[model samples]
Target chain A: MARIIQCVPNFSEGRNKEIIEKIVEEVRIMEEVKLLDYSMDKDHNRTVVTFIGEPEKVILAAFNACKVASELIDMKNHTGEHPRMGATDVIPIIPISDVTMDECVQLSKELGERIGKELNIPVFLYEKSAQTSLRENLADVRRGQYEGMAEKLKDEMWKPDFGPANLNERAGVTAVGARMPLVAFNVNLGTDDINVAKNIAKGVRASSGGFKYCKALGIEIKERNIVQVSMNMVDYTKTPLYRVFDVIEREAKRYGVNVVGSEVVGLLPMAALIDVADYYLRLESFDHSQILEKRMFE
Target chain B: MARIIQCVPNFSEGRNKEIIEKIVEEVRIMEEVKLLDYSMDKDHNRTVVTFIGEPEKVILAAFNACKVASELIDMKNHTGEHPRMGATDVIPIIPISDVTMDECVQLSKELGERIGKELNIPVFLYEKSAQTSLRENLADVRRGQYEGMAEKLKDEMWKPDFGPANLNERAGVTAVGARMPLVAFNVNLGTDDINVAKNIAKGVRASSGGFKYCKALGIEIKERNIVQVSMNMVDYTKTPLYRVFDVIEREAKRYGVNVVGSEVVGLLPMAALIDVADYYLRLESFDHSQILEKRMFE
Candidate 1:
């Protein structure tokens, strides 16, 4: 089976329809890569594009899109609610199937180099592709945004991983990295009691010393008359959805509440759900080859 | 999304490798169709080929393979342990994704008619595509093996659904139909007592007033020193695997036996596993669109 990877890139100038279309066209024209989704946030002034394919094709699509962004988007005139650093702000390569983090890391570096050398956009390899611990966190690497990027790059520790050590006036700088696929999962409580949901969230979140890869919070669904423990499952392969769900159920029971239902906010890899079934059904010696649809690739 | 369907066809003269290859090559040559598997049993003197693709492509592949079988396989000279009726013995069309049973039934009829008129092979539309209640069961349609089929066709009740009432001299006759995808699932018991497994199998089988789409039996696994309730879940959309699993787990507790684990013996539709996860997790408002890989079709 071919290794599949997903690339989600955020680019500046989402408010300009013509410019966003021009950048997105690069990815759309690639027959080998599927453009899963692309949405422009007017407030944030950024367009997030999601696409997946074989590793090589996905990287090519990301590179082509970034090149278009560099030529079309001028970060010097960019302003939005969200922080910015370049025309193509950030590109994160996520392993979807038959792929590993190390492979994704290498892919990110290759993409970064192409965008930097060919497109002339300075690239910072953050997250799993980071060369230094400080740069591992995207927030730290993107701290100064576009305005402060030129001055920050002058510092010896803040040198760009690829391209010129200085920033580009028009395209600014790009953050390219590898990361685990994130799943937005929310479990609802039977009752409207906010406290029950809050406690459950605290018990399953990493910040509160719960599941190491979970980031969770309590939220109210006023229309449904229920409270939910919403979570960002950063690494389901390590901290599976079923484990967190079982914990939340037990935690909610203490508050005299039952789990109403759970929701997966957006698209998630099939492996994430397969893990849940494997745990609950006690499926033994099951593998991807046993999935009838997986035979399509062959 | 394209409507995908699976076709499994069995043919006579499995002992001849050249003949089997000629038949399978027709399907393998179809660029749009994927041949999932094909195996020949020397003892049974039969070969079963599995393939899937969009409805039209799958039907075309099946036709091409059957055409090759009709030309090369002489059923008069065939002898097999397994029951036989024609060179291309049987063709079962199964809905896999973005498809309904009604659509599959129609596709089977279309394929059957083509085989009858174009190949001059008498066709019996059994199972879901059966024109009469008596023909609904494949066993009834194939009551007489190839040797007895010519005499059986003389009866008005056994008249072919398509083609001349008389069987083709070389090809004999074929049974083409639509049916639900079958999943082979088995639940293992902790104890070695075979009776415990037998009782659980009886409680969850359709014949014993259990789930409507399930067929089950008990068997002892000598290697594991355990007994198992093996089942054929005929229609998971109606009789879900999780419900049958939960029932077996509960039933085992009465005999002081615990469910050690369960196994899915062969390839199963992804929806079967997805439904299991949805039920166990109490997932709400989930749809196939939320599955990342499903987006590939779009």
Candidate 2:
């Protein structure tokens, strides 16, 4: 079986169509890699490129795309609504199929080494690929962003895992790591009770002793007159979708609130959805191997 | 997005490894084609080769593999535990990604015509690609198998959708069609009573007024001392997995039987599983677009 891996790199230049096209063109040139999508957020001033292929091909494509982004983007003059630390802010490698997390961690390390050696940019490993406990959280590693990196790098604890200890004025620093597929799911409540939404979010997030893998926040969409329980499912396999949604439903019911609808922000593995179906359908024991498409992989 | 299609061709010479390898070798050479799996059942004397790729590439691979099978195998001497119709028994074209059933129907028809013209073998189009309503069911079309084909070909209704009106003694006849992804799912019952399994099958299959797209039968696995409810899910989208399994569970309760477990026999589209998950999880209006992997395609 071919080991398929996915790499999604976030570059700090989303407003320029010409630059985005050029960066994406590098990935398009690779015959083996399938470029899935690329989008830029003007307000955030960031561009995210999504692609999947064999592990080696994906890594090579990421390296090439990053190189192009570094050349065109100048972090010294970069400003955005979102936090940033580099021209190519963060590059995450996700294992899609027939590949393990450990392998992804190893791939991240290899890419980080190459970026440091070739581009002279600082590289920090986060999540599963982190070298130290402090660097495991991306937000922690990118605490000061680019502006504070010069003084921050002086501390031994803040030293990057790869590249020079000093900062690059043009490219800044990049965080590369491997992590489980995260599901950005949001549920809208029927009522405009922002407090109800906030309480539900607090009751269902990891920080508040809720579902272990869930990180949630409540946001009020003023125009829609609805409150949203926005969430990031970090480890779907462990908590699964059914469990999370059921808990949220139960919590909302206590507040006399009804869930109007839900949304998934991105792509999900087939297995995650099957598990939800199995539980809801009350299937005694359902294995995904029974699905016809899975047989094609056999 | 690339239009992905899958073709599974069942060929008649499973007992001979050399012939099976040579037949599959044709598809293996295609650069875009991914040969998912090939398994030979010695008792049935048949081999099922599963592969997927770009629509045109899959069609080409299927044509080449069938050509190889026709040259090496003679239907006159073929014997198997399972039903046989020709050197290549059945070739079903299934829509995988960014493709529609109508498009697959057109592709199947074109491919069937080419096989008839090029291979000089009678080709019957069944299921979605069938020209006539009577020919939609494969079993009805292949009533007598290879042994009965020569006589059956004489009738107007039995005339193939492609190739000559007469049968070829060597290759016999081939069944070609376009259809939805068929999931071979089986649920084992806790009891040894085959009647219970049969009753449950009747309650969950289309033939017996169950799910509209479900076809089910009861089989006894004597060695395991368990009765099985074997099912072919013709349209997972119309009749999702959770709905069908729930119906079976409800019906099984009437017979005082419990479903021991369920097994998925082959590859399944990720969407099918996701629907089940969404339903059970009560994730109102869940969309696969939220999956990170899917974002690559967008």
User: Which candidate ranks first by lDDT, i.e. highest?
Assistant: 1
lDDT of 1 by residue, B15-131 (tens): 999999999998888976889889999999999999988789999999999999999999889988999999999999999888899999999999999999999999999999999
> How close to the true structure is residue A28 of candidate 1, measured as C-alpha lDDT?
85
Window of ten residues with lowest summed lDDT in model 2 chain B: B289-298
Backbone collisions counted per model: 0, 27
lDDT of 1 by residue, A1-298 (tens): 2357899999987788998888888888887688988899999999999998778988998998888888888888999999889989999999987799999999999999998899877899999999999899988988989999999999999999999988999999999999999999999998888888888899999998899999999989999999999999999999999999999999988888999999899989888999999999899999977877777764
Tens digit per residue, CA lDDT, model 2, B130-197: 98999999889889999999999999878788899999899989999999998777887878999998
User: What DockQ do you compute for every candidate structure?
Assistant: 0.77, 0.45
Tens digits of per-residue lDDT, candidate 2, A28-143, equal 99866888888899999999898887789899999999899899999999999889999989999998766789999999999999999899998999999998889899999999
Could you tell me which residue pairs clash in candidate 1? none
What stretches of model 2 exceed 4 Å from their correct place?
Answer: A12-24, A36-46, A77-82, A189-195, A219-227, A255-260, A278-298, B14-17, B37-46, B76-85, B144-150, B188-198, B217-228, B252-261, B282-298
Highest TM-score scorer: 1
